[model samples]
Target: MAGPGGRMMAGGGPGQRSIDFKGSSKRLIARFRPERATICALLACVVLSVGLSVIGPKILGRATDLVFAGIVGRDMPEGATKEQVLESMRERGDGEVADMLRGTDFTPGEGIDFTAVGDVLLFALGVFLVAGLLMAVATRLVNRAVNHTMFRMREDVQTKLSRLPLSYFDKRQRGEVLSRATNDIDNIGQTLQQSMGQLINSLLTIIGVLAMMFYVSWILALVALVTVPLSFVVATRVGKRSQPHFVQQWRSTGTLNAHIEEMYTGHTLVKVFGRQEESAKRFAEENEALYEAGFKAQFNSGVMQPLMFFVSNLNYVLVAVVGGLRVASGSLSIGDVQAFIQYSRQFSMPLTQVASMANLVQSGVASAERVFELLDAEEQEADASPAERPDEPRGRVALERVSFRYDPEKPLIEDLSLAVEPGHTVAIVGPTGAGKTTLVNLLMRFYEVSGGRITLDGVDIARMSRDELRSGIGMVLQDTWLFGGTIAENIAYGAAREVTREEIEEAARAAHADRFIRTLPDGYDTVIDDDGSGVSAGEKQLITIARAFLSDPVILVLDEATSSVDTRTEVLIQKAMAQLAHGRTSFVIAHRLSTIRDADTILVMENGSIVEQGAHTELLAADGAYARLYKAQFAQAVAEVD
Candidate 1:
């Protein structure tokens, strides 16, 4: 049940544990299976584009050799023709090179063929243009696929959240859950959109460039290949070492965000306690930890590019030095040597990209793991198959030797039995932490009973679907919740069917909320903020009462329903409650002894067991736990009045 923040450092910022990269990556890859056709097409474009890029340097090298051949032929003696010069050049054992140089215009006195050179330059430019176009198309296709895939992933995560049980949220911070939903998903989307295509293109370029380099000159290819292992060694080592830091960085970010959210939401409380300095100190500590983690992660990732660049430059030097010797010995042409140098440089470019992208991939995988964790969390039990449905349910209820506990080691309720006839008000009074609310929770099926059974009208509540059982009961809690919407909409929130404006107004009047609501400028149409900030606590409570009234439930449960109101408002709310409970079964959990004096039966609870049960006069005569509680409250009220 411990959330991400609990796993973080004590008195510091957040930290995270490592996850299984292989499993997460496999799941992430499976998300795109539906887009296989688009991926295949993207791959085709990549191959076409990389093929053109790989061949361009070699074709341009042919032009360089052509220019060289023309210069050599132009310097030939007057008696010797250009063809004779070419025959001598062919004897140097470059037959393929000689064939490529054929049909080029060259004269004994002329320096070179400008027209032929222009044609070769134009052909190279055309190849580059075609490759650029293919690259553009491939980029567009990748974006489409990435965005669609992300859309589906987000939808799945959202759906999963709804299916998760209330218990899952009880142990986690709101900010932590939101961070996974927003920040983690965004990271996954960005990595896939920006880095995925680059990863594919870099890999293809590396393969194609390597093949071309080997074809041009195996010796130079071998020299360049040496950097491959060195690059991998540096990247793999640095990447693995930096990954934990990146995970820590993200976890710290989520923790810091959660802290900020809590502080902001409770700013009034912090100020009231004059704890500003303490809050700032805590924030600074967390911020410092985040800074440290981020610095280490970025620094480690940054080292890869420069080191790979150095390796590439060193390989280029070796290729140049070696190829020059071959050219000088007439074993290789100037054009061939130039082409080999380009290929050597191209080979390392993709390796450098892959190294640079390695850190981002690691961060992305970390995010994916968190997202997958949420999706894989335990969900609420499914509704009973062919679930029972009761027709026109009566309000009679019973608990048969029920035992319950929040923590199994510490027993709360044990061997308790109770029964209530239809249309009777049963008041439950208890000290703090006496399991009053826990009993209500069990009855509502919020938490299943650890032992025994609770029933409504002899039908086991467990056999009925949660929705079916809950539909007949209305709950007005001490903490009232109102969403951002019109006041009328809030009041009619849980109605089984559409409620008329007249019905809404009637319910509001019955809850004593109509007078105050009418004072607002928009009246029932007034828009409330998310926290019902504009309304007072008493008013918020009234609205919740009105919501319950609108539902017209068969049974009502009010947990300290009048706790927040002033004395005058409390009296009015009491009257409203009297009218609402006249003919319906109601369970009232109240701390105010005077409020429940007229209850048909009063149950005095302590710890988790009912210690006293009787009418008010009978309980007082017994001089037991209920008598002591009523006397204590009466004395307290008298002291307050004096």
Candidate 2:
């Protein structure tokens, strides 16, 4: 089930789950191999600590037996001491009693040897103190190792994301990617930090306690071992049942987060469309699913601890009864019985802990599998050996028999050819989904052409490195994006080299954004929120235009750049665009027929094919597709005027 951070609860249950415990564990262990020295030291400390723990109870039992013997000796026949009682036993020819009391150091009148008991207690205290110190050191070492490994893991994930192609992101939800990067990584980190050391120590404790239990009495050890298989069976059954639910839980959580992000970002549209109730209903459905999954996972996994506790208590009862019988029969001494009982509990304690941690361990493996999936995703193909870089690039560009399809079965553009010389404007006009922006994406190398070549002045763009090709091009998209930074920073974002404050202002002025900037409370220094919430859409577009201007690119791509502005502002932006495109090649993708009427060339695209291409007036004179589109827009404009 989903947790507070929208993470799935531990132990994802069955059905085509991707969790490979053995494989993931091996990889996880390989990641820690570099810290083997520290791990070894930590293990050494665990051994020492558990060794001390195992011996302490046995030593304490000796003290208990001494006290009992002293009490019995002093209370015998009206305050006779241990030495006197032994002498009386010898005088009465009780050889067995004399031998039993041989090592009991007791004074004639005292009930117990306070000095010897104090010494044994002090020694046990010292052992525990050292064990505590070792454990503290081990804990610190574990933290350091775990944090270091996770730090490197996060770095790898970040680097891997940068190397992945845009297609990878196109196929997945943003929230799903984010969940893997943040929540899943954090899960791995927490599990390693919390469970890794405990697992090691518990295992060692179980082994040591078993050995000590057998050393005390094999029959009692067998009684304790009886409950172990039962505990394992229960834990395994519960864990197997809970695993799939955990997977579903995380999958639903990712979906829910994606939905929330979409709704929040588009809340304006939701309210405008009167979809609040519908949105709330969708959220409730997701929330209820998360709750149900979470409850089942938690309930199934949660029962493990109590079930293990019952087995432990059952083992405890068996040990007590069996050991009491041995003690009464003189097969086991009172001291041995006490020590055996403590050992039995100690042995079962780790079993209980491991049983309870079964779910967490499984959850960690699931998280690891998800993380590995991202890491193992197909990255962008590397550039060819000895990749070429454009030198002294000209603004000339050509699309030679270009063909593309988002899906191979449904071809979009086929055998398309185009060429633009330096210092010319090419206006591409089309309806929505007519592959207008797709052409721009191909030009920018955001997506490679399916079967064709796009070339710069002479060299094919496919041969040049993506960074080199993109470095000479500038783009302004329909959806303006401004990061959370000062207004000047957004404007200066286009420049690869450092830009001076004066240059930033000049670009803004050219884009007709300077007047609005000066009116703001902080002007160019004003901090923009992530969504640029306080800024008008037109203003945001202007800022992006200014950024493109500052970049001084040899080729410019403006796709719906002026779509958000008012008519007056559009006129200003068009003037700015004219100046920006004066000495550079530009591709202008626009929907408005009036806007591209002055273009040097206009290409009318329909269904991903160029139906008409010519100067605006020429196309209108031919009375082709462009002519019909212009007539429709012209009629709409006149209707508005009337």
Candidate 3:
């Protein structure tokens, strides 16, 4: 849904949106398929580890019984059978002690057997030690599998982004998309790392401990089972309630990040327009929204732990009381009752742990959904198979009744027909919202033409692969983009193959960037960031021109390429561009009329139509739209000069 400022909100909006928990969690698990072997090993470790851990309490019970039986036997007289001593005790009206003693196996007059107790204790310790070792191994395996899955997911996202159409990015904030790729993915990884192994172990432990509990005493086991349903209900209800908040939390994060990115990037603009307070207010609003979403998510999920703990304590008390009565009746031994109590605790601990992890799982799945949404996004149309190319590879391009619209209902470029001969310079000039750049965009197939076919040397461009079409063209856009690299590397970026230092320098010289580069601290080797921080706007423009120069493409496009440069540099660029355009088809979209007075052809565009077309002198003599634009610009220049 669209929100204020046309920002998209998948889950964070005025009304909270429910998450597809089951589907998203299943998809997240499916991502680990490539690590199937590791997962299987981890499961093996967990199963064996849990088996040993469950048996440890039973073995410890034997040790307890040995010590306890010795204490009971030590109080009895020698030379009498175990039944005789118990019968005498009952006769003396010590019936409770006698009943409890009937379950013990010990020699009369024997004291606590330290040796037997030590041996049993050692066995129990060994069982637990091995279990702990196996659990550690399982943890390592889980980490490996989770990390591998996350690595592949990142790769998939990166590959997916490259296939998405320009329009997809045009409509979305860069930061919003970036959050999916970085923050959301990272959150998922962290959650999985923290929860996946433990969740598996907790589940297995519950099953194992439940079995042990039933083995010790079925009655106590039944008592422990009473609270199981309650724990599950608590977990599910709290999880469901908190899930939407988790979804909103991540959505708010993306929105806040998008706002911050926009504000930071345009901080100078905000200050220039004296809108600092407005920007700050907007930030506070987004920040507050994120805080609320996060708080609610945590609070709701947070309630699960204490509630589960309460249910577990209730189960514990019930088992303890019931086991005591069974021991008193001689139905179960004291050691057996003790072991049953331990089993009950083990069972409840997993339940409590899983309940506590409800929020973490919800949060992780929320992030996974965001990433899956990106992966599921519609991609650009596939490239043509058995692609066609221009036979002669000349720089001739023609738009035959081409039409296009960003919105299907609103046309931007309609029936725009034009043909450029090999090596001719065509200059496009128009007011804002004119179809000037849109024409170049179609010619390059940045956008598919809606109504008619655009062709290169008579072969329809749509029939060719985008890479094949773009490889033949070099463009210097009005808004320059420079990756963080040396100046030489930036210039060489236009070339398809590796370029030499001398060649890079020669291209820079042609674009009039070499002089300023040499004046910088590290000359051509100086590195700038993505935003071209170290270079002036004109210098950035010059570097882009240099990049285009290095490509030496058959077709060239300059979209206000010299708009930032001073008049002196513009004259130098014009001279260099003339030499560059000597035998290549060139398309220049210029706002400055003086720059294209000598072009072979001039087009005046307005509202998606070519209103006038001629040579500069011809159009000026005809006194058409082109003449008026030129005259207006000339008067403006005169006024500025005065």
Candidate 4:
């Protein structure tokens, strides 16, 4: 939908929060309820596992206390007791001592029962097992949800790209858009699936583990938790430093991708000019920048785990010394001391995870920001009301005082007016920057006009649904684009109804593409890769023309459709153009005078204004801009032939 300043909002969809992260996480988290459920389950596992794990240490400590109590019963002196005998006896009575491990009033089977303790141990083991499995399930669920959302995001971005104002692409590099569509999306997918998944689990696990730690011993819990804030501060520092680095890395890669794409597209020109060294030098610089950025970012992130561990170890040492003193003073039980250490680790582990996730979280945030930016781009204006769609549209187009500009400061099409009656052919000819293509752009609503208006059968085009307006008109671009698909599929690109073989052949024949199709081994079924393959440039252009032909639009736009084709192909395309122009309104942008010689009206634009307009003979009689351009262009053509 439209937003402030009449900009189209493409950033967020259903359940998506705004790109800004300030207070946005709360909304994003709420929208991600399924992922939140997985987080909760992970927390359950963490709490359960931590609780069960502490029991082992408690059991060992209880056994120690029981042995100490027995020695006191035997009236053995601490200094006079034989160390070897104590050790040997303790080993032999290990199972029994643990069974009778009681804090007080341990005369017989009053406080501690070894049999019931065995049951407790088994229960703890079972809890740990179940928790592990639940944790695994939570992980799988989180990944599934994240991946599904990311896939949808990629798809949505692509769709928006397709519908965006054509001017949006004018100032952008193809490589940069390509990188965002492919590489940026891929990075985001990995972060959400692998890294963000763990981050969510870790957050919940930390909360649960800390709760258990406090429940066991608040004093020890406090001691264990001291590392939390410390680690967090350190992580924040490192994360801040690394976040920008990663963003830069992403940008640098986009630049590199752009360079690569440009090189590949112009490989023949580069070779002809013998500029391999210059290209290699540029690539080397890009590669070196990428390597440095990657190394620094990873190295900084790597230091987090070790730094956190060092803090954890310090906390561990303090807990052991302080807890041991409390136990010796009889203020704490041996089991309590043992459980404290386990809880301490549980408390610190999540902190470690939080530290580690800083890298991924930052990367994800950066990517999300970029994706949201694209989605936030302005969309063309909506129609005032839905126009009545026709099964077969009438061929009438009028440009009344139509003016446009890529930028407001410079007008491309001045306040010029033109009209095409039903079944009429209009040709536009101009110098390189004379707004020839800009006329087609406005008619297609690829960009809104700066002034005046254009209409189809007296109904203002701006008041018509973009889809209905475009569907009524067919376009053949100068540069033909074919996706990786079968020739038949490409030919039937935008037709709503399924195209029959006969219809496909008919369109192909009209475009003079049928000859090439039959020459291919697979004919219409020939599978083509995105790379130039199994077809010539002229053949591809013909196929695109055939696609437009199959749509059966009442108005046709040919933007230098035959400019890139060979002489023979041009003749064939010219014949096809004549047939396609019959019984329809057609707009042709041609640099070649020969192609537009027979057009009913020829409008020559210069500096965004129509300086010459009339029939061929009429323009020549006026001896204005059109006549000069014709003579200059035609003279070069004759010289080239000679």
lDDT of 1 by residue, 444-532 (tens): 88878889999998878888888888999999999988999999999999599999999999999999999999999899999998688
Q: Best candidate per lDDT, number?
A: 3
TM, every model: 0.90, 0.92, 0.97, 0.86
For every candidate, C-alpha RMSD to the true structure in Å: 4.3, 3.9, 2.9, 8.0
Kindly list the per-residue Cα lDDT of model 3 for residues 1-642, writing each as its tens digit.
444665433344525667788999889998899999999999999999999999998998898899889988898898888999989988999999888778989889889999989999998989999999999999999899999999999999999998998889999999899999999999999999999999999999999998888888777888999998898799889988888889999999999899999999888899999999999978877887787778889999999999998998999899989888988888888888888888988999999988888888899999999999999999988889999988888898888898899999998988778899999999999999998888888877777888998888888989999999999999999999999988899899999999999999999999988999999999999999988998999999999999999999999999999999999999999999999998999999999999999899999999999999989999999998988898899999899999
lDDT, model 4: 0.75
Q: What ranking emerges by TM-score with the best candidate at the front? A: 3, 2, 1, 4
Q: At residue 136, what lDDT does model 2 achieve?
A: 87
lDDT of 2 by residue, 43-145 (tens): 9999999999999889898888878767865757756656677778889998666665555455555568889889989998999899889888889889988
Off by over 4 Å in 1: 1-16, 78-111
lDDT of each: 0.86, 0.85, 0.91, 0.75
Give per-residue CA lDDT, model 4, range 1-642, as digits (tens): 544555332222112232344433343344456455556765565555545544555555555455444544444333433444345446887533332333322333133455655665666567667767766776776677777677677887888897787778887888988888888878777777777656756666667667766766778778876777788788878876676566666666777898899899888889999998999878876766666556666778778889999998998998998887666554666667777777677667778877877677666666666666777788656566656444447878888998777777866777889888989899999999989888888898888888898888877888888888988888999988998998998988858689898899899998888987999999999999775488988788889999998998889999999987888888878887888889999999998888888899999888988888889999988989998998998899889999
| Ranking 1 against 4 by TM-score, winner | 1
Kindly give the number of clashing pairs for every candidate.
Answer: 0, 9, 0, 5
Off by over 4 Å in 4: 1-117, 388-392
